[model samples]
Target: MKGLVCKVCGYVALDGNKEICPICYAKNVFEEREDAYKMPDFKAPSGETEKKHIPDFTVVEKCGLIPGTGCVDVHVKIGEVLHPALSEHHIQEITFYIDNKFISNVMLTSSINPAAVIHLKGGTKGKVQVIETCNLHGKWFNEIEIK
Candidate 1:
């Protein structure tokens, strides 16, 4: 009946300090506290530069991502804009097949758009195989390679 009281978790305290009471520990009162939450200094403490980009090895171009299967969710950039004749939506199935064995097909790029970026199955983080392709007249060209 003296200090502030927790409305959400129903935690009552006579004195409100920097530390939170045990009853409302699960609510993480410190992070949501108006008085406690202060704007931290944006500058790094010493020599902290930009964080390195950790690639998802599992969903890269090198590793082929199977459809309908759970794989690493990643974004793949395949092929360049080669055909001005084909507008935006024209890519159907720009894939390559040899010997009827299906050596390698289109993993990302499609005719609807210039590039085909899809989420892999693994959904973890690793290198995946992506084939770059382009649509010319009617034939699809697979050129770029990534992993």
Candidate 2:
């Protein structure tokens, strides 16, 4: 299993040739034999995702305050707004709460975006927990957050 990486996970595929990573199978795997880089037409930004504004989309990150205390960030649409100060030409909000207590709100605007919020923050939490994200629809296509 030395060079074995999950086709869908990019992690060492412990079980071999499977579309899913043994580790992420239950939580992130969509189907067997799926490519990590390949996204279905429905999930990608092709149809309704591009034209409409998905609301209340959130990403939750966890920390030490709770065993799984997390923070939530978002991916929203800019629709038709322009701001030189913002980088991605789009705007998103982050509704943050920890241990069930309301915290401060923040904004995320960037030109360079990477990883599915689920993929990037999926397993990022650790012992005593640090960060966990729960995105409503931004996983593979379109979503928004308003904090």
Candidate 3:
């Protein structure tokens, strides 16, 4: 899909316009990418190549870390088969969204695993979207509904 991508951190702006990159905090470094991301065919069986790039989500209705808050915990893991975390090729970052609105971005390095958990405010209800960028594989996307 066409979008504005951050040259430094690979964050994509689906609306095609952003003065600064939300992930990298880079100014005026956005470049238009004709194929910014690839959405896996969830309806069909995934191949080995697809399994290593798609983002996987695990949602908890109630928050575990902070109990009695009614908050939700959205866990995102990059790929069904864990992607490599070497210095040469690793997951650069993972961006979160709720109901088509940007939420947060988690930057990763070679030492850390390609996973993240975002705690949502109480009573949060909407479709949760996740995009993960791999240094060698470009970007991959996935989404889930929280009702």
Structural similarity to truth (TM-score) of each candidate: 0.25, 0.20, 0.87
Q: Give the TM-score of candidate 2.
A: 0.20
Poorest stretch of ten by lDDT in candidate 3: 14-23
The best candidate in terms of lDDT: 3
Q: Residue 110's C-alpha lDDT in candidate 3?
A: 81
Quote the positional error of residue 43 for candidate 3 in Å.
4.0
Better of 1 and 2 by TM-score: 1
* Candidate 3 residue-wise lDDT, 10-44, digit = tens: 78886455787776688999898889899998689
lDDT of each: 0.31, 0.30, 0.85
Q: How accurate is candidate 1 locally (lDDT)?
A: 0.31
| Residues 1-147, model 2: lDDT tens digits | 033333453332222334444334643343333321212344565444333222223344442233453443333222222212234333343323323222333344454331123212334332110111112222122222223
- Candidate order by lDDT, decreasing, is 3, 1, 2
How far is 101's C-alpha from truth in model 3 (Å)?
Answer: 1.8
Q: lDDT of model 1 at residue 29?
A: 49
Q: Which stretches of candidate 3 lie over 4 Å from their true place?
A: 15-17, 26-29
